[model samples]
Target chain A: MIIANTLADGFVVFLTEAHSWTNDITKGAVAETDEQAESLLTAAKQAEQTNVVIDPYLIPINIEDGLRKPTEYREYIRATGPTVPIPS
Target chain B: MYRYDEFDARLVTERVEQFRRQAQRRLSGELTEDQFKPLRLMNGLYLQLHAYMMRINIPYGALSSKQMRQLAHIARTYDKGYGHFTTRQNIQYNWIQLKNVPDALADLAAVEMHGIQSSGNCIRNTTSDQYAGVARDELEDPRVYCEIIRQWSTLHPEFSFLPRKFKIAVTGSPNDRAAVKLHDIGLRMHQNEQGKTGFEVIVGGGQGRTPFVGKTIRDWLAPEHLLSYLEAILRVYNLDGRRDNKYKARIKILVHQIGTDEFRRLVDTEWQQIKDGALNLPQSEIDRINAYFTPPAYAQIDDETESLNEQRTQNPAFDAWVQANLAEHKVSGYSIVNISLKSPKLPPGDVTAVQMDALADLADEYSFSELRVNHRQNLVLADVPQKDLLSLWTKLIELDLATPNIGLISDIIACPGLDYCALANARSIPLAQEIHQRFQDIDKVHDIGELTINISGCMNACGHHHVGHIGILGVDKRGKEFYQFTLGGSSDQNASLGDRTGKGFPADEAVNAVEKILNTYIMVRNDGERFLETYRRVGMKPFKEALYGSA
Candidate 1:
């Protein structure tokens, strides 16, 4: 799956089936095979031209029980907000 | 705080208009990301992991109450209702949208603050001792020259773009709270044999992938030759610093590869040409800048204090805050108050808008409507009257800013880490939180006394892990979070970099090492000795032994 953030306001997003960015990773489009992931990336790269989302890139994730989850701790944090609640 | 002059004011306003257009162009797709990246960085707008981050330079760390209140307003209105006071003596709003930053910059400029030179490969903010004017042991107020440098470096045609970013820090005191030796250019004020005040210029020092203590380029430089000499050194670096590799582009790398002696000779050769040129500042200009920093008229205060002493006896908590956070003021009956941002729950250096507003109010009531951002990720009410210390402490406690862990073990200095920074390899805040929880007893922490534990998320060393008495650098080892420890580092005038323990601990077990080390210190320390003193006297051998157990 590929991850990106909306350039308009930095909302966490995942590239979906319609080549659109969504907040839900479960709804994230699966580009399984290497060729498919490459082809999907080609579509994701076009989002940068629209200037809607910034720096769309791939994140290594596993399909764990019907949910897409990041393989690394750091990337998981990028998917969510901070691990701790920020000050009020 | 130094007020902007007509020239300064005009320049900032014009720059704001320029950036507003540029941001609009980028949004309208007139400028591509590649083209706009440098432009945005030059304006202190960074595309961090989460959102656009804006760095606002608080020149020499001084802020008038009015300017600080303006910052609070910005935080509440445009940002995430908070600002992060950085180790560079600047404030960063981490959640800025691209559209809001132009307005944010304009807000900052209205109060004589701007983000210009706060980012990009430029001479960044010139940080100074937070207690610059009020330091009892200070030989001269460093901010006088700090303001002078701020003017000289702002929008300089010659140094608008260098091989890499440059930093300069100034200190007037012998105690070196400014961490001068860690800057690209560190200037320590001193007196010559004739008792003429000048500077001890240390050049080519920085922290990032490579960290080194700056070498003293000139033993002493006369005040008149300051700007000329600095221009010469910068010119040499601009001409010689590597551009091929960003990692090796800093002046520190150039100084190392060519040797400081050779670099000094080259700079001096350039200096000889410009020594008495237009850049040589006249005392008239120096005096004008000095006039801005003249001490506020303080009321006649008693040399010996009774009220504060009685308060200390009556309230132990207030006394603890006084003992841990207050510094000796040059004025006999004044105290420099340090308001710690390292609370038990919040992130270090994070101050909310409400907290900022409260601080502004507190400053008005007690500190002559002035405050300073300390390099240790804290705030300073630099001129609080000794008699008002208790009152200020009470107010601070209500605001949750009264963390009595100033230089103690719980006073951890940490970077935003993986939480906010795009460059971080591991999370720093969680580890810092764990340690703060582990060392929860204030009495024990105060007893541990004056131990600095700095944490960095990566080798960039934004947390200054290299100079911590005990350092924790978070590392990602084969996809798992691990922390590497270092010992015997000090950021004092007598500075020393920490030695790595050659040990790594799991994320949760990192606090175990700290506990064992503190316990060891408790057994071995001599009376009246701080952590670094005991570490220096005993050496890292004992610490290594205590931490890892004979291997």
Candidate 2:
């Protein structure tokens, strides 16, 4: 999966199947093969060039129990909010 | 407490407008992320793991009541309802939006504060002792020198783009509460044989992947020579410090590579050329800056010991707070009250907008309308009258600001880890929260006695974990989270990096490891020995035995 922070607000977003960015990781476009990953990253880069997002890159993910989950904990944190409760 | 003059005001206002334009351009697709990153960083805006984080400078850890109120407003208006007070004596808003940052900078500028120099490779916010003028043992107020450096280093074209970010800290007292030995440059004020005060200039001390206790370069430098000597040192680092590898780019690395003696020789050679130049401060200029920090008018009064004892006898919790949070003031009737932001209910150093406002009000009412942010991630009400202890304690309790965990086991200094930082390897906040929750019994915490547990999500050492009595660094073992523990670190007058225990503990077992270490300390400690002192006495033998089973 390709992910980025939106250029306007710097909020974490995932590249969607529609070549657009969504804040929800579940809605993010996934790739199974290296070629698919490269194409997805290329599309994310296009989004970056168009100023829809900033610093786009690929992140590993798995379809666990029919839910999209990031492979790395850091990436998982990026997809969700902070693991700990923030002060209100 | 230095008020902004016309030039300072104008500089900040102009910078805010410039940043406003830059942020607008970035949003409008007129600038790429590559182009906008540096500009945003210069304004102290960072794109972190979750959202944009903005760092705001608190010059020498000092804030007026008005400034504090403005910060509260900024927190309520531009960000999530809270702000994190950092170890550098700065405040960071974790949930800031890039679009909101320009306005936030404008808001900060209204009160003579800015995010400039809070990030970037320039001289970052110059930190100083929280009890600068009020400490009983201080030779001179360090904030005067801090203000001078702040003015000189702001947008300093010569040293803006150095090998890496540089930090400078000053301590007015010999006690070294500012952690002088762990900064890029540390200035320790002391009297010479002639009773004249000057600074002992220490250079190349920092903590990260590499930690070094600063070595003194000049034993006694006259006050006038401070700026010139600093310029000379910075020039040496700028010209010769490594720029190839980011890891090996700090002045500490350079000083280690080419010995400190050689680095001092180069600095002295450069100093000879510029020592008598315009950078040399005049006594009049020093006095001019010093006037801004003049002691507030204090009334002649007794120390209120009888009344304080009466109150202490009545409320045990307030007594615990008084015992833990109060530091002696130079003045007879005044006490330096530390308001611990490390309540287990919230993340360490995190303060809500409501809390900020209430604390500002408390500062105004009890402390001459002034507050100081300490490097230990606590707020100091520097001038609370001794007689007002009970009243202040009651208010703090009402506000949930009376945590009485200063210098105790639960008083953890932690950085925003994988939760917010882009460079983090594992989560620090949750670990800190867990450890803090495990030790919430104030009686047990006080029994632990002056132990510091610092957590950093990565090796950047933003949490000062290298100098923690028990340092916990979060690391990733493959894809799982693990923590590396280091023991016996101190960032005091005698600063030393902690020794690492063998291997890393899995996240679930990390707290159990801490419990066992504490148990071992309790078993072997002598009377009146601090955790660090006990550790130093026993060496790592006992700890290693307890932790890794004698090998």
Candidate 3:
């Protein structure tokens, strides 16, 4: 799973699976449980109007994935903070 | 020195015309910013923060005085009368107007130089040793192979829209001054046990967010298989390199994920398919390209050791300059002189139009009408005669080019950073200036000995911080600037990526930290050792202890 949030016009937050490629249980259809992933998938699909097709299985899993129970094989985005920041 | 024959000339001219049309269309608002962005990038016109930036190729870092003068002319006429030489051995004009880009292309094309493939996700300018032909330890002139690759890769159709940008560097010299190890693909010209000259190909070495030293994929790749092998690598990267994430788009990440052995196997399979294809590089074409880089005719002269010794004894400054700037040349009575662009108070690698013209004049007068833009961002007069050393040094000093700090602590490699580059997170130039000011004392710098302190504005590694003996990477902490330091890195033959020396430091404290580190090295060094030698012997422990001190 890969998710990106547009902080600025040029700046984007890219998220991917920590260990391996994500499984697309929903296939071409959207997951009914999430709104953020659906919106991102729509945007991504629009962006891929040209011949260069974005892999449909590799949908953005932002809201659902974050809300789900954390696991060892979970996704990790290079967020704008230390992975383990020491307390000042 | 690779003169464009009819085919090359036609292609370049056509490219200029094509860019001219594109520029005209964009000006007429026929193309939007998004639409025109790729087109301009294809022509090497980048929309930087302030203005349009133009990157001009210095094919394999080799340039004639005529071509250099053209660059100088571009700087004076089209830009802000200064040019920034990049780590990739290309020069960037930061203040180019979109209206004048077409004219700039035509001007560059007039000198057999074009910005083609300088940007875009295509094969870029093939860089080699600045002293490629003239270096003493070179197996052969690497420029010959560079030129050949240039021809093969120029506007290569299939590989144009790869996963991301691809860079290839070749080095004939044993020293590896070209930083071949840090490139997407590095080719070191070598002779196998059979005494047959070929390349030792290393793949997937790059430094951005993820820094990796390229692994040797092929111990020996014959000259004939160069293009085919490169195609294979590109094909593998193009097919499998991550396209979803821009950060993970580099071949290095792909190679890392796939593992070197698996990647090599895939490349080998690809190579088996494409080997001895049309891109096999015909013998006649090779000969044609080789002809351009043929060594200039020289009048045999005895080494002026006695006179040089007399001058060295008389002038301490000259002696220091000679020690730092002079490089051993293939010819006995000649030497390559590095005119340091990293003068104190001046932005590192910022050469003014006047300096460029002066270097052009010096190149014509002192060298065989040749100048080289080194990977260190210094200009080189590769064939300066032994007798003219004093006079040349005097002239260079007058032009503020004789810093006598080449390969010293003050001789820093710095990118424009936030000062000029839009992508930069923090200001690298100011940091470099601060460091340069700190080490302006010549005596202290000399005592510190041969050290390369490379600074990059961002993790793009445009300044090649990963390979620096003391690497400083600028990072943005919130709105404030912070710098991360790395130790014990080298770009030479035994190339290795630097180890991160703990946490990042604030911009103001970075130089002080560096000073502390250097002071520790000076104290602990065994028997007049260089900075790298000491760092190697002691590892990072002593330096870390000195820097942090039981924090």
Q: Pick by DockQ: which candidate is best?
A: 2
What DockQ values do the models have?
Answer: 0.71, 0.82, 0.02
Candidate 2 local distance difference test against the native: 0.92
Q: How far is B530's C-alpha from truth in model 3 (Å)?
A: 1.7
Off by over 4 Å in 1: A63-66
Which number leads on TM-score?
2
Please tell me which model should have the higher DockQ, number 1 or number 2. 2
Interface RMSD for model 1 amounts to 1.2
Q: Write the per-residue lDDT of candidate 2 for residues B1-551, one digit (tens) a residue.
A: 79999999999999999999998898888887889999999989888988889999999899999999999999999888899999999999988888888888998999999999888888999999999999999999999999999999999999999999999999989999999999999999999999999999999899999899999999999999999999999999999999999999999998998998999999999999998899989999999999999999998998999999999998999899999999999999899999999887888899999999999999989999999999999999999999898999999998899988888888899998888899999888889889988987767788889999999999998888999999999998998999999999999998999999889999999999999899899999999789999999999888888988963
TM-score of each: 0.98, 0.98, 0.86
Writing each residue's lDDT as its tens digit, candidate 3 over B427-463 gives 7777887888888787898889889999998998887
Docking class of 3: incorrect
Candidate 1, residue B106: CA error in Å? 1.4
Highest lDDT: which candidate?
Answer: 2
